[model samples]
Target: MAQPRKPASRGSRRGRKPTSCTQCHLRKQKCDRNQPCNRCLQRGVAHLCGDSINSNGGFKHSQSPQVVSIAPPSPSPRPRRVTQPPMSPSLGTLFANRGARAFYGSSYFGHQVASRILSEEGQDLPAGISRGRDTLQSFRDESSSFAQVWDLLGLLPRQKSTVDRLVNIFLAEVNWSLDAVHEATFRSSYDEFWGRRFGFDDLANVDLRWLGLLFIILAFGVLLDSPPHPTLDVQREREEASLRFYWAARRAIVIAPSFYGESTDIVRAGLLVTRYLLYTRRVSESWLTIGFASRMAQAQGMHVDGERWRMTRKATEQRRRLWSHIYTIDRMISLALGRPYAINNQFCLTHEPENVWLDDMDDEEANRAVPQPLSLPTPSVLSSLLYRLAQVVGKIQEKCFGMERASYEAVLQLDANLVRWSEQLPPYFRLDNPDTAADDALPFLPWHRLYLHTSFHFARIVLHRPFLLRESITDRFRTSHEACMSSALADLKIRLRTMNSTNADSLRWAFGAHNLFNSAMILGIIAVKNPHSAQAGAILEDLEAYCENLHQDPWLNEFGMAELKVVELCISKAKDSRYTSMTAYPSGTPPEPPGPRIQAVDGSGRMRPSDLESPAMSSDMSSIYWPTVWEDGQFTFPGAADFSTWEQMITGIAEDNYGGQ
Candidate 1:
């Protein structure tokens, strides 16, 4: 239920009010006042049965602080067991202070912590009282109530231990987008927030903004929980839990308009909404959400350098960091969809963040000084580095692949620039280099390094593959196909190393899968063309190993495996052709290759085509085969799949027969 926007106040009672159980009894009416009596119970309300402790018949006037009631057990009862009703509103009058809920015990009302956090028992807000909503929300010194700070614990797992475990799992597994939510505030609230109740959040102290942000973080945590629960079971349970918190946070945003205000609180929560969409396979939805967040961020003047606005040191750095993340998100989704960038570099003038160690910033809302460089890179430093790298990636995607097509020379230059970018990364950022940082074998080194290398290879493929197919046209149109193939082959080698190590689990998820899947078809084609090469053999081996993990996700896995199989089949045919040529040429020398051989095979994969369905001429006569599979993962035309179909497709030499064909 949405919270009422109005504050508690003594307003005119212009509408119908209910008569209490005691009212009918005093009037000597046979009211049948069981709990509410027949009169009040007919309205489906659990009417308070106690005598009026106050002139207002148990309910406090809008002028006073409202608290929950503690109704006593009824004297007469003979029926199936039921959950007891809420305390009578009159009972609350005995308590001198409004903070009465703190005095109650769990057993006193047979209530559980889950009930306190998850279930909405005593609180009820009027829905759609359109005319009265404004009257109630009118100005007051303080309108804050339990509704503004409700415990959404019911939205989490029923087991407290399970919730804690998932929290750990979430933090560990989630690819922290923009590294949202400072670790300190989130942990601080988490420690004391659980011991709190609806009206008694001791730690939060009525900071509804922080509480709302906590829920968003927990939602992401739930979604990223993996491994511990096994595969499918964990996925199902975590999804349910994530969705629960996702709604809770989403509801908080809509109810409290303050969340969207110019506070650091909104920065993390706002971006997570888009992050959540992407994590859940809602790609299209994520794009819209990210775009919305970018607009909100720009509205807050985040596009300008924080220092220029004279903001706090921490606030300035945070804005720059967040905007960088937004830009990265725009690049990732835009590249995926082939859409124009939302964060155009031409307009955004915000200074990029510097390499400040994250550990130093852990408790740094107070420290006004700029952070200094660490002996080696930290997560914070890595984040800034990645942001800058993603900027380059976005620029390349937009300029080279979008509206402007780079010439062969420009492509070569860009490739060299990527190499230089990798070379320039700080010592710790380059995982392969034998630096002092690796003397002890960094804990998360392999996981991060694999991602870095994979992304590098992906950029190379994206930059170079368009020209690989055009290489056969003419020297002018041709580009270095070997460079493209070599880059792809290098990616396969790195993938093999990753899957063989402990980091393989994380590799199968999120952008990890995206980076790897983009090159599957390209590698398959390379393997087919050079099936006997040792390099090709290793790649095909690792490709099979990688596809095994993808089996858990059917959509991408099936398509990926299908394309791999096409390459495998093509390689097999190539090997058979080589064997046939070897026996025909005995002197260890082979005859000059013929221009193009054609064959015809029918429905049984490699047979003859039906008489009525006479084969037609193929578009690419220069192509060695009658038909071919293009680099875009599509077959050229009908009968393009089986090479044998080309023989029967040929035209006769005679003029009449040639015309007929």
Candidate 2:
């Protein structure tokens, strides 16, 4: 029978938001109200809301219905049973039981049994399989116990530990690959992958300025920690490898189209790579690295010309003073390498203006002034490059032969050449401009300083040689010394005058002061050897006064102070030492002296020597005095001196003992 409808109460008739289902509301308890209220629907209970069945057995209806009524039907119930299909085994169970048992269970059996079965079933199984099976069986027999197998499994190392152990191996592999790439690209070595592909061409296409600096650093690093190669050929091969890697990394930096901040990583990597190349003696490649970097800077809106590949006037002129310094470094390197002056050989500077006047040119003028075919300049950066190269070469020579006669001679030759070349540089070459004022004259002190230091060191080597007096080399050395000193002094005077000028705050002026003082010290040392040379003494006094002035000044650098002290020590030694001269013998006379004669014994048992007298000498003896054997007509100063005393003086100066920190 269907259920009858229930009548709604007056309160229920009012409109309100439904909080719960009608069945739950009627039950008056919390309900989830999923499909039906649990209490009402689960119990199959249908109760009226505060109402009873009508007398006519008909559903009662109210103004608003609380619930719908249903008619009750006669019960004729019969339940039916349903059968379900079987489920298949899961993948995990299948793999664990069937697959594992098949593979591992047979292996646990003796290899004899397994091999016999394999032989019967297989047509041509690999011979190694029997060995593998035997090993597996042995392992299984050994670890038969559950606890043993469990412990063995637990004893295995973790993934993290394994990864840590392989980290160095991975890094070494990467380095090797990068080096191979580098060799193929820049060193003209045949690295199959790098050579066939044009991977490094992009890197080569980058600006040269950046590449030059980077290459130097790289070559320097390699040279410092030379590769473990038996021969020069192998070493060169490895170096070329390093170069290719550097180029690739640089190429990556250039092509990376991203924000400046994002590109820093690439730039930093390129810098590090280039530094390594430079440390390796791959100087040519290093220059290329610098070129690339300069291009990159230009590409980033730095105004660099691609054809004559150099930074624009506006960009470089701001740092124009650095040009001399850059030029000096390049020159030094070329000299050290014993290569002909090829400015564009390793690095390109076609974009740099020929004249300083171009720096101030207007746009229209600059456009017209730009040369049709940019000619490469001479090796202008030789000085600074030579300075750095000397340091590197000195280290190399020291390792090969410490204070060897041959090494010293070679050093002297280089020094002599440097001085000669520097002197030969025309005044116009030194002068940045025709109208450059006396105060603004290009400082020659740096050139003089470099010359004097190199020369003095060369002189020390000469004086230290045991056979210098016997050898004809001394004459050649003396001549070179005079030439170097005279020219150095002339340049020194100009530098000193410039330093004393009012515009001393200028970078050139400051450098002039430093170079002047430094050159004076070197000259002072040279003078000590030639104390009789009036010019030498005058220069020494001038140097001393300069040092004193520096001590008074409050702005000298620590390095400058140290150098000054070295000069002072050289001067003090020169003043205190006694000068001696080597005597020249007549060309035809026998070089050997007369032998000493033995006298007859006077005693009977033991032989006793009697005083021997020479044959009667002439009453009138002519005494002949010759000029002292001055090195090139200059006195020789003792090469050995405690340079530490000078070091201390400089230290005191640096520490502000003179209130000039």
Name the best candidate (by TM-score): 1
lDDT of 2 by residue, 397-485 (tens): 33223322133355455555444544444343342232223223434434333343443333223323211211132243354455446
The CA lDDT of each predicted structure is 0.50, 0.35
Cα RMSD for predicted model 1: 16.5
Model 2 reaches what TM-score against the true structure?
0.33
Cα RMSDs, all models: 16.5, 30.6
Error of 1 at 399 (Å): 2.5
Instruction: After superposing candidate 2 on the true structure, give the runs of residues whose Cα lies further than 4 Å from its correct spot.
Output: 1-305, 308-327, 330-352, 356-365, 370-474, 500-506, 512-517, 578-642, 645-661
